[model samples]
Target: MTELEADCSRCVGLCCVVPAFGRSADFAIDKPARTPCPHLGGDHLCTIHEVLPERGFRGCTVYDCFGAGQFVVQDLFGGAAPSPAMFDAFEVVERLHELLWYLADARSRPEAAPLHDEVDGLRDRVSAAARSPHDVDVTVLQSRCGALLDEVSGLVRAGGPSLRHADLAGRDLREEDLYAADLRGAVLIGADLRGVDLGPADLLGADLRDARVAGADLSQALFLTRLQVRAAR
Candidate 1:
């Protein structure tokens, strides 16, 4: 797709499926998978398009689908409208795509990287499910995918210089040291912070979902987990 057409308007709101939301510090409401946003329409368009921030949907405004949704729908699914089977595929694919973005952001790649073997294996399973005439159990795929991403994220978070409130989304920082620094309210939507040290630091209300911190240290980080962190930002 051309740059202009590559924008989210061509997609079927896939980002909304890949991740989740709660009444957290970032989101003002709670929502579940495949459930249209109260402001979204049957056409998959946001009704509160212009006033999202004012309407308490700042996270929604900042989301970028990266053309994955349209690619899956038009290219993989043969340009047909989403079927129940396609919808199930969309959920798993969208989630994987979001995780791919997270890994990319954590590693600072200009484009999405190939999934780790573990993740690739999970992708294969999801693919098999997509081919099935009936819907597959996405929960198992979702859980396994989450685990693999977490495993790969540790390698992604390594070797970065100390980052403080860095706009490091979509980059990897596996096993990196960010100890005792200021990261207050940083936009880290798709970052990998696995096994990184964030102790005695300031991460007041930073975004952490879709972010990996599985082996990382967050002890003494002010308002880190105690404060709610939203996904899909």
Candidate 2:
């Protein structure tokens, strides 16, 4: 799954140039879509990367391209400099790769063994679409992946608490037994989660920004992305 992980050294900073950023708690300044960030250097590197959070660009730190940038640059464009078309394709490939990540994770679970074949089929389809992003309907793919993930979650999280999409921001949850809980899409910003055992929790799309996790056990947290971990304090 290393191919699904971001490798900035192999990318040309497409994430810094393609997406628009509004000035907020996460971003230090407003940047229009297709415009390179002011902090981006000529060599395709972030000039303030080491101090992005201190410089008020914490949003940049948690942004994950899921290796889409490098894949598009090296595999699709043969390492050519990014163009307008490449920028457009970047978003599509990113979504495909993200879906691939979840599909791969679902396949890895022994509890989801019954659906492994289906997961593999969908993963193959998503991988094909990543190669020719313009030909695929991403919304349809997302719906399929979401439905399949819901089934897999049911199998893996058997009888666990369903806190899907719950708003728990800034709440203290240190005493909760969240293990194997279905916390998909839960808002946990600034929530106190110290020493919590979150192993096997379904954290897909959960907002964990500024959430305390210093002593939390996330070793087996299902679908927990690097972005979520990085955003949490």
On a 0 to 1 TM-score scale, where does candidate 1 land against the true structure?
A: 0.44
In Å, residue 116's CA in model 1 sits off its true spot by 11
Candidate 1: lDDT of 196? 77
Candidate 1: stretches off by over 4 Å: 1-6, 14-32, 102-233
Compared with the true structure, what per-residue lDDT tens digits does model 1 show for residues 1-233? 13212345566665565456887654678988656567766676777779877877777755554445676677678777656556666655554444343333323321225444444456556555544424556577657755554444334333233455678786787745676555656777778877777755545446775777677776544333322333422
Among all windows of 10 consecutive residues in model 2, the one with the lowest summed lDDT is 153-162
Residue 126 lDDT in candidate 2: 94
Listed per candidate, the RMSD to the true structure in angstroms reads: 10.3, 0.9
In model 2, pairs of residues that clash are none
User: If scored against the real structure, what TM-score would every candidate get?
Assistant: 0.44, 0.98
**106 Cα displacement, candidate 1 (Å):** 8.4
Stretch of 10 with least lDDT, candidate 1: 103-112
lDDT of each: 0.56, 0.92
Count backbone clashes in candidate 1: 15
lDDT of 2: 0.92
